[model samples]
Target: MSKVKGHKSVIFDLRLSTFDACLLMQEKPKVSVTRTRRDSAAKEFSFTADSIPAGGLKDVRAKAWDAFTKFSMPITTDEAWRRTDLRLLPASDFKIPKEGAFEDLPVVPESLLKPLTGEQHGGQITLLPGGSRVDLDPDLVSKGVIFTDIRTAEREHTELLNKLIGTIVKPEDGKFAALASALAGNGVLLYVPKNVQVETPLHSVLWGPGTDLAHFSHLIVYVEDGASVTYVHEAASPNETGHAMHAGIVEIHVGKDANLRFVELQSWGRHVWNFSHERARVERGGNLDWIFGAVGSRLTKNFSDLDLAGEGSVGRMSGFYFTDGTQHLDHDTQQNHLAPHTTSDLLFKGALKGKSRSVWQGMIYVAPGAQKTDGYQANRNLILDEQARADSIPGLEILADDVRCTHGATVGKFEKEPLFYLKSLGIAQAEAERLVVEGFFDPIMQRIPFEGVRERFQQAIQDKLSVDK
Candidate 1:
């Protein structure tokens, strides 16, 4: 398992012990030669605490398996995983998700079998193939609101699950969120207590069934203080092509004067494989609104983050994505403004066709005493096919001496004077390029105020602008 170019990664099937995978490359020897690297893997901190299924937190899962063996995955030496490529994944011959049922998986879709919003929008959770099903609104659980099943709140809410599980995307913070904290086991929890004002809106759906499976999902949202909620998170795949692997973790905590509204949707299946890590933290005078949408998977790498920790906090992030054929979608985003009149805003939009490829990297940070911070970031892309490719990178960093940061990025194609002004009004250059690509994704799907995830993101942009491309 240590042959240079004949590569074998996905951490060589996770049971590490080649001197614990070279312990952080023998202490960061220049991160084992990076710059455009092509295979220099090692950084294992070993995690396999009997694959954790509630065994009294064996000392916090042995420090989350030593932060998933100190973060390791060889996406050619991580420059934010340099343009995502896992050697066209057969990811070390996929394993992990076995405990099958639901009559041996694969067949979902009676439109994802009920509940994609419409229980007056209140509570819902659906993760099938042997586990997960949650339903709420017993008068908001008689007013204390602790929506269930994250291993049943790790056995009846252990003091709010040991103070908010892994405290903001930890588990060595990388290496596929330390392999989703070493194999995620049944997740879903939404607790909105203090000043509770739920007024209907909570939903979750994560599905991964047969064919070479490996699916892990975990979600935690705690909105307290001046509470308010509207949540929805989803991931779906089934209808095999043989090869499935999804790694996920989403953790959000918005307290002091809290209010949170997040709606996320990912449509996986194309012999899926997605790596994920999502985060959020906003305190003093908190408020966060995040809405994101991604079109399926055949290879996706995601990294999302938002931290505006305290003092007049507010964060807004909006995203949209679409790709076709040889799909590969990658996104890395972050907006951090730690305290002092904080504010952060980010926007992302995408489009691609046939020979598919998409990647967006964004960042805006303002720390150092954060005084008067106000940050902004933007990314936009469109390329209908010329062997489609899009990459937008935007960044900004300020060690604040009173900050107001800004960043922007754009990758283009498909703007022939707005498709020749909608084809001189006679419309029909394929319906004026599908109404100019649905008006270029209608302002981030109308800022997603969750009307069933903006009607499944406008029925997935009218089935990719009525295909035929």
Candidate 2:
């Protein structure tokens, strides 16, 4: 492989073979961490078989524990984490929520409990601290659809769960991933059998604990060949003063010719530190549409990746985020074209207010022999306040000479001309600013399949604009 490196970008010419290109793709730069600090932080919480819920997945848990003990927390010195700092996280003060801690479910706020789409979901699941509840349409279930909590799946769908648990996002992906896999009990699973097309969408909500505790959740979505489904997931927490942490994982697999639409909304409380790894793989002729919305958390660092693993596969990612107060949100995304004739597109737009900050780093990679690959990525940021900050980094790595790959990044303040135009029309300054911001996010907002969710996100943006005004 011949390398040509530029600012935040790399281009490689794979003249050897496709296998060689695949091997090189597996190589990642190692980031060193402070061992003493890592060990000190790890000692704060203990994970044992007794602490974890009794069920299957013992081997998976054991492998995850090994990885968790072997890996250390990443530091800011790492390139991917350079823009986000974890020094403010009080790791030693956090405790793992004991089993039965959520025997009586906490009063979830109306905003979180409310349905984003007015229509009823084909299936719905809520994952609390220690327990979960699920409701699915009997017709879908009769059609071989599987939608249930992890515990019940463990008891009933053990073989399938065991086969697909860590295939996409392995425990060794990162330190936090390992930790989540090791203690994963509060989770939901959605499985659609071959050739089944569910007309209605499925929904899942993961509510974080409000206390000074840590929680881990996992999500698996499997769509078999010729199947189609849409899934919406929300991760939220109630406002609290104490510090808390959440480490989660999401794995998605779309079989040959299958179609999957996945939506993820994150609204962690101001006192929570959130870390997660989410990835999706599309097989031959498969299609995937992914939407990400971020508007909460004291600090959030997440990785979202799409792997077009088969020819004729297509993937699209649309993301929008709004940050206010002292919040910090970071997203790292990757579009990997692993097979020929694959297409991928990504666009992420964010707005920052108050003293908040947002970071977006995107990469589009085309493997060798992946000819006819078309990939595009762009990140646009709008800063609403002088103190607010946004960082946009877009990169590309292509090994195929015939592929078309392009990336762009822009970070700018709200344009004065637009605000002035609105103000001259008798709109108030605040209202004018809101209109400008709304227009800036229109492209991404339009991509949202659910109308209610789009309106909810608009209201959230307005709330952020109203803060400290």
Candidate 2 regions with alpha-carbon error over 4 angstroms: 1-50, 103-105
Candidate 2 vs. true structure, TM-score: 0.90
lDDT of 1 by residue, 40-128 (tens): 44223233566655543446656776677665465644578666767656656665654555556665576754454555557777776
Q: List, residue by residue over 76-128, the lDDT tens digit for candidate 2.
A: 65677777878667766766766667765465565665667657789889888
Candidate 1 ranges beyond 4 A from true positions: 1-60, 73-82, 85-116, 124-135, 139-146, 149-152, 155-174, 179-217, 220-231, 234-263, 266-292, 295-300, 303-418, 426-434, 439-451, 454-469
- Weakest 10 consecutive residues of candidate 1 by summed lDDT: 1-10
TM-score of each: 0.32, 0.90
Clashes of each: 4, 0
